[model samples]
Target: MKRYGHGLVLGKFYPPHAGHHHLVRTAADRCERLTVLVCAASVESLSLEDRVAWMREVHPGVRVVGTVDDIPVDVNDPAVWDAHMAVFRAAVPGRVDAVFTSEAYGEELGRRFGAESVCVDPGRSVFPVSGTAVRKDPVGCWDFLEPPVRAALARRVVVLGAESTGTTTMAWALAEHYRRRGGVWARTRYVPEYGREFSEHKLTALRTLHPGASWEEVTFASKEFPLIARRQAQLEEEAARAGSPVVFCDTDAFATTIWHERYMGGLYPAAHEPRRQHLWLLTDHTGVGFEDDGLRDGEHLRPWMTGRFREELARTGRRTVELTGPHERRLATAVAAVDALIGEGWDLADPLPETP
Candidate 1:
């Protein structure tokens, strides 16, 4: 028994907090057809794509659309309303029987289409959260944000260098450092080296399935490098989505690209295509000794590998910080760099680079 034939929920959804979700969901419940308009401006940090994605993810049944316009948020000005209504009509199309909002403008906006107004929590009593508050202190308002929004807001730091340059050690230390900050920054997460996971899986397959597989046999299997890159990418993205504000990745696809050159004889295009956003903490091979995990190429190969990392970093023009010295000193340097990057407004346009 729907009250309205069609419903429309429009918002800036700057970060798309829980309050916006409630309003949208409630409207969808009361209407047979619901459409959410995620209106954003160029000045906002969160992209229109992210806003639409979050809404659709959280409310799968409802139609979501994103539009970028510089229309001032002044409903008192009829000119502003006219411009907004134009954009709304373009985005939605067809007819709207109800306009849902938590603001007084709901009635006036609805009147544009001769639709009924559905206002909920105009006083903010139901969901005591606002977009402005969330923007000012996302960590403070973590509970108000959906997982996708939180994930979008989460900062990712990648540690990369030759094998055993204290990448894993520094990654965990960084996560612990943020975790100790506590409250909103409390649940820091560190992604382990996925190359190791790939190697282990291959070794298992060789033992059981192949029985007597050679290194060349496994390396030339055609699926090996791509699978590793894809799996590593998948793990990094999942960790980024659910991890704390500062998600520390032991190594990323860029590092995998470097490894692919060494182990797989050539670079795979997909491995090198990760969009450059992470503050790359390149672990210096100066003082740190390389430890041979059974999968390691060789101790001597590290300096060469480290050179390759430098080459790739230079080639990609990544935002990088070199970590050197003892474990504590290296961690301190990495932390400082990360803090500086954060201050400079480091964030993602989207959660991931275009990965195949």
Candidate 2:
């Protein structure tokens, strides 16, 4: 290993797997000062900012920088090497004393800068993974990815419906089902319904003060819905970051909008917009008895609320799959839908946009 004043590591780090980490960490150890350049192009799916953020988060010791480059990727033409060298020099801060890479071009790149080229693990013997493999099969390669990238690629299955529709129950069931599946390295995570948490807190407060209050009297302020929506998003993001390839959300922001309409008589702007999710598993109320807890309005409002949820879902135009039956049956239906989505090549790295 050759020591250097300033070392540089450059790559797309498209989904920055363990191999990239090995390369950078190895470089950082040998050099006094190391800089990692994450080069992204227009054709790449992951944004340049996101790639930079991941590198910064993972390797706080090394300087991480990102640039949008349209230069030829992996081109060996000598004529273009000068052009590429200019770009690489411009991308890095000052003079580079050493260039570290596992590619054939490492020697040439180093020579251009009058620096030593150190090639580590050219055979991929240390970290047996590639960005292409990670992109093609994220779940299969889940162990290779860093937490931030894994979280970003986690497939979200949002279970949604009106009150007493068993959204929470089903959400847990789906998560458990995936977790128990044998030989799968990637685990599942569940995001509980945040609105219900807020409502329970408010209900406890009301019962303490009022002593005898009807469900109708436990009304929510228009202002409170936005808070619930914000918390819901935060919880979902937190769960993803914690490293789960498949995340089951009890409900999402779109459902929060419906709840605002139910009590507040209007939409809460903060909760009005829908975020990207793979599938909306709408739970049906048929044959599912509506039992009122202290927070629920009653069985009478279930039908109307369910219809309103349907309307909002349709208006948003996301991929929808309705689950109706007993608990076991509902669970089976949901599992099959998610499996189908995966079988059809659902790329977690690049989420599909909401249907226009």
lDDT of each: 0.79, 0.82
Candidate 1: C-alpha lDDT: 0.79
Could you give candidate 2's per-residue lDDT for residues 1-356 as a string of tens digits? 56888999998897898999999999999999999998877777888899999999999999999877776644566766776677777888598899999987789888988888999899999889887778788777888888788678877889998789899999998988887874542367899999989888887788899987666677778888888888888888888777467789999877888888778787576625447578899998888988777678657777888888777778878888888989988898999999987677635353321122
- Model 1 lDDT per residue over 266-350, tens place: 7564535456246899888888776766666556778888888887788878888888789888888988998887676533232
User: Ten consecutive residues with minimal summed lDDT in candidate 2?
Assistant: 347-356
